[model samples]
Target: FVNRNAFGHFGLSQDDFERGMNGFDMIAPEDRPRAIENSIRVMRGEKLGLNEYLALKRDGSTFPVIMHSTAKYLDGKPVGIRGIVIDITETKKLEAQLRQAHKMEAVGTLAGGIAHDFNNLLQAVQGYAELLLLKGREGDVGYRELQEISRAAKRGGELTRQLLMFSRKMESTLQPVDLNRVVEELRMLLERTIPKMIEIELRLTGNLHAVSADISQIEQVLMNLAVNARDAMPDGGKLTIETRNAIADEEVRRSQPELTPGNYVALAVADTGQGMDKTTLEHVFDPFFTTKEVGKGTGLGLAMVYGIVKNHRGYITCVSKPGEGTRFEIYLPAIAGTQATPPVDARETELRGGSETVLLVDDDDSVRALGAELLQMFGYSVISANDGESALQVYGETRGGIDLVILDLIMPGIGGTQCLERLLEMDPRVRVVVASGYSIGGQIERVAEIGARAFIHKPYDVDEMLMTVRGVLDQE
Candidate 1:
């Protein structure tokens, strides 16, 4: 189409003939090498290969150009290259973020499992200690000593429970949580727990909104903050609890990748005690890192709080300065509607057990023994089993007369859940109660979906267990 001696030619818009700046002359200095490499590859009658270079526009500005082409052969001689290209910078960024999120999820799952096992052991220690104190009687001088032992064990168990909750390994049933109702109910408990010298105040702003989160864990957050505030005020000061509504904007959302722009109910705890410096504040959420004295803290408190807030898909921020004060503000997504939840009836809590046969299954001898003793004390005949197979055997021996089965989720062979499946196969009419220390295999979800007879968590009180069992049986 053009003379062989011509130095350059344009395929379209040859208006540069007189006003003259050739296409190559306008190429960016930084992109010239990439363009030449592409030219060489195309001249060899092959694909231009993937490459990105800056193209100089007529306005003397540069823009990214991703040119794709393979050599076009004219009668066995390479002529030019041609292909399609599009910018992909945005797509690459999204892929990187997704990889990071997946990596975090893998680590969280591992932490969840470790915390679960630890909670089970804690349950055993706390449960047995409580049973021991109850067995001790009045006029016995050692009863007081035993009570102190149980109290210590209970405290240890509570710490384990907090860790498990932080790791999201504890059984949690998230209902339509009422923020106002919860705060009002916990006011008295909070007051009693904090030091008498510290003044406590509550402020409610904006209409409170419902949020979907573990109720007990929310209480845990409140309690942890209150205790921390009390400790901060060694010389005594004022502590404020406030609630309101929040709207996250783009700037805030960009700062917190896990948080997005949305409507949220904000809860805040602020103290007038000595505050934290920049260095201490930065490590506030790190586990096992604390400035407090060795005997005074576990350092898991803030870490646990962090995990819970993240698990709930909420956002948290802190503001502090040395000798001033510290404030923790949490914003949880608001749930829809103000549906009134039915109040827990006192009738369901009424204890009951008389002459009904129950098959109890647990690998731990102490737990099985204590369960049976507690059930028997309420006039129930409890046949104990060490595992799933044994439980099935015991039930079969009783000729399908098992009115209830107290099944443990974690066991050696033929565990509680599997054993229950087998027992139900033997007799579908069998009524059973499932219990677990650590949350297992979507246990809470299954309970809500499957109309479970009842569930009693480990480290439970005798009255609580009896009440749940009685309530379940009453439905039948």
Candidate 2:
């Protein structure tokens, strides 16, 4: 034993050190028994010497360590024990990293199959939208129906994008977000959505945790869950939504390796309707596994939710039984932060008005006529071209007086992207807006970077067309 001065340096009293209890209290709760037993074994002259255990701190937090001890003797009688303790926290961390990597690799393999099929569906949707709008006459009832089809096709296109995101093939902006406000903001729309026969209730808790998730993705998951619940209870029932703080402890880590033993937020949606048996519950999360017959359900509802949650580094659980109800729970990591603010709402999203002569390019004549008519209705002078080469011919002949240029990205010969390059060469100051069916790989999202003021998706409404045209013209 040493003086009190020596004991003070180690944060222990002289008596604590002498009684062999100084390190005993430092052993973590779960490892303390084994550590103590190993000490007794060494003292009794057992052949074993070294043992691995966890040491705790003043804050009650635990870290792994390998404690090695040897018996000290004076005159053939044991007097004291000298031991060396090496910290192993970093080693445990590396082990966890290896396990997580393997988990992601397995998920990627499964997601690849889903993405391939989804792409084929998207191509059909894009191609059909191009055809339907082509067959419709302006201001006719048939044209309005075609416009609806076009809108649906675009949403289907977005679904495939989400699938790519789930496969980790698409890019995302990761940031800290507060989930509580997101649910709060969407409350109005949800209330209006559910039928009068169904009861809606919200149980939102305060001091709730924030998670690092994409806001749009989280919204999509919630929307999907709501829609699934709505479909489950076609006869009308109670739908409950809840948000709360949770901790993924040792028990949880066993089943969900994606979760860490820390704070989290649980977003759950429950419905009181005809629930599924064990057999149905097992396949509930699988794609196209809906119990709803015929054209009622696509079966991709839960699958989409599953994909989105996995992509966010989270897990989802489902509880149900025959003649009862079902509850779906999602857990996302809680990182303390505020929600990202929404962008300004645009009045219109398609190209329309301009008194200045405009150069319009599209391989399809139907999209061209409708696009031209929409612009003309907004009081803008419209000049049209059937393909990329014709667009350049018209632009060069007009001597750069074109107020705006709207280019369709997909074409028979020189593609929209290549056409953009040729058009920019003809008039460097040209105000352009890229229009696509999402088949052009972010043709709309990257319009500004390509020297265009904006991007517009096809099947444009007259007002939306007018608004986009006004906004771009105003910018010029």
Model 1: pairs clashing at backbone N, Cα or C within 3 Å: none
Tens digits of lDDT, candidate 2, 1-476: 44454344335575665667666776778887887787777778875756888777655566787778877879997766667777777677657556645664566556654654554455455545545565567896677777777678677666556555445444334567667788887777777888878898889988887787777778878888887777778899998889999889977776555688888899999999788898888667665578888888766667667767876778788898766888999998787666544533545355445576666787766667767765665567899998887887788888757888888766767876777777788777778887653332334435456786766644443454567667877884
Number of the predicted model whose TM-score against the real structure is largest: 1
- Tell me each candidate's RMSD, in Å, in order: 9.6, 11.1
**What CA RMSD would candidate 2 show?**
11.1
CA shift at 21, candidate 1, in angstroms?
Answer: 35
What's each prediction's clash count?
0, 0
The residue pairs that clash in candidate 2, if any, are none
**lDDT digits (tens) for residues 1-476 of candidate 1:** 22322222112234554467544544578887767777787787655467776656545666555666677678988766554444444445445546644654555466566655655665556666666666768667777776776677667666666666555566665667777677777889988998889998889774667888777788888888888899899988999999987777776665555667787888999999899998898667666678899888988888778767876878778889998999999889987676535335345445567788888888877778878887887789988889889888888889757788888877889666667677777887777788875674466567444444778877656677888788766674
Model 1 stretches with alpha carbons more than 4 Å out: 1-136, 184-201, 236-238, 340-353, 393-399, 412-422, 440-442
**Who wins the lDDT comparison?**
1
